[model samples]
Target: EPEVTQTPSHQVTQMGQEVILRCVPISNHLYFYWYRQILGQKVEFLVSFYNNEISEKSEIFDDQFSVERPDGSNFTLKIRSTKLEDSAMYFCASSVGRSSYEQYFGPGTRLTVT
Candidate 1:
């Protein structure tokens, strides 16, 4: 079975700096999403993308955050300005359809803002 994959398993950046996290979701999936877990907190939804446009986004996905499928196989999350509170294990997930509850998640990219 195909699985989602993320780049730069870990990233460290200074506060206020920009960072882009990359991922490759299962090629056959139709819905892609970005989520983050702050330390011991629950997983929080950031944004969901479909057909080259944003399908849904949570409050956490403010102007500072953006997602894109720059190509046929790559999906990316960009944080315009990092803050200590932004540090977390960011996960990229994909599902076969919008209503599919079974999402495949990548190993995750750990982002640390200093």
Candidate 2:
């Protein structure tokens, strides 16, 4: 079975540094999304991409953040400048394109900014 995978399960960075958290989403899926959870808050959707274009994005996806499909199997999120508030667990999810289908989540990448 194929699944999403994220790198550097944990990362420590100074506020102001750039961080590129990587994810390889399952192939044969048409939708990809990025979400984040601040230690205790609800998971917030950042953006959704499909067919090589952004399908939707939330306010949290500000100018400092961007995503790309670098190759056939890799999806990446880049934070231009990290802030203390940026500390959170970033999750990459994929679905079979249905409200009833469960979106599979990666273990997650925990980013910490000081």
Candidate 3:
């Protein structure tokens, strides 16, 4: 009965500021991912990480965005500069295997930018 956890459940920031969203996936999970959902939009995959390195990334994950596994249990996503378009609910997910495994998602971090 393990689940993902995120910090700063809600965040508000001015445009162009840097933001870091934190997540802790299920302790035994190996595959981690970052996804975002803009209001009224579909959930989109941004990046995936495994074995302390990035395994896959979408176009949405550009130079302005980055992900890191600072330690064994924590994963973080950092946005170098925030834009109005970046305002969305970011979700962290993890799975036990590369394919066919269920991905468990966190409650998400709602980011609002002005």
Candidate 4:
């Protein structure tokens, strides 16, 4: 199994704005990723595009957010404009199987609807 970590377990935001959470995943993993959870909802894979070109991404991965494979170990997603619905649990995850495809999730997305 892989290791994962997320920052600011909880976050509060206004009606319209932007927020970027952070995560640190297993050091030896190959694939890095992000996901989100709408309170009391199922976990959704926002994006899974890899190798710096987005191998895959969800419809939710709209213009509002952009992701980057900045380096060998860090992957980041930035949101340009955040609406009240943007509030959700943001999770960072990692996987070793480029083919096996098993993902381990960080704490989670808890974006409050304000």
| Residue 87 C-alpha lDDT in model 2 | 99
Which number leads on TM-score?
3
lDDT winner, 1 or 4 = 1
True-vs-predicted CA distance for residue 46, candidate 1, Å? 0.6
The per-model lDDT (C-alpha) reads 0.96, 0.90, 0.97, 0.74
lDDT of 1 by residue, 45-94 (tens): 99999999999999999999999899999999999999999999999999
CA shift of 87, model 1, Å: 0.3
Off by over 4 Å in 1: none
Worst 10 residues of 3 by lDDT: 1-10
Which pairs of residues collide in candidate 3?
none
Q: Write the per-residue lDDT of candidate 3 for residues 1-114, one digit (tens) a residue.
A: 788999889999999999999999999999999999999999999999999999999999999999999988999999999999999999999999898999999999999999
Q: For candidate 2, give the lDDT of residue 86.
A: 97
Supply the global lDDT for candidate 2: 0.90
Candidate order (lDDT):
3, 1, 2, 4
lDDT of 2 by residue, 1-114 (tens): 888899979999999999999988888777888999999999999998888878999999999999999898888889999999999999998876846777889989999999
Listed per candidate, the RMSD to the true structure in angstroms reads 0.8, 1.1, 0.6, 2.1
* Cα lDDT of model 4 by residue, 1-114, tens digit: 456877668777766667766666677666777888777888888877455677778899998888776666666677766788887889988887677777877886466646
lDDT of 1 at 37: 98
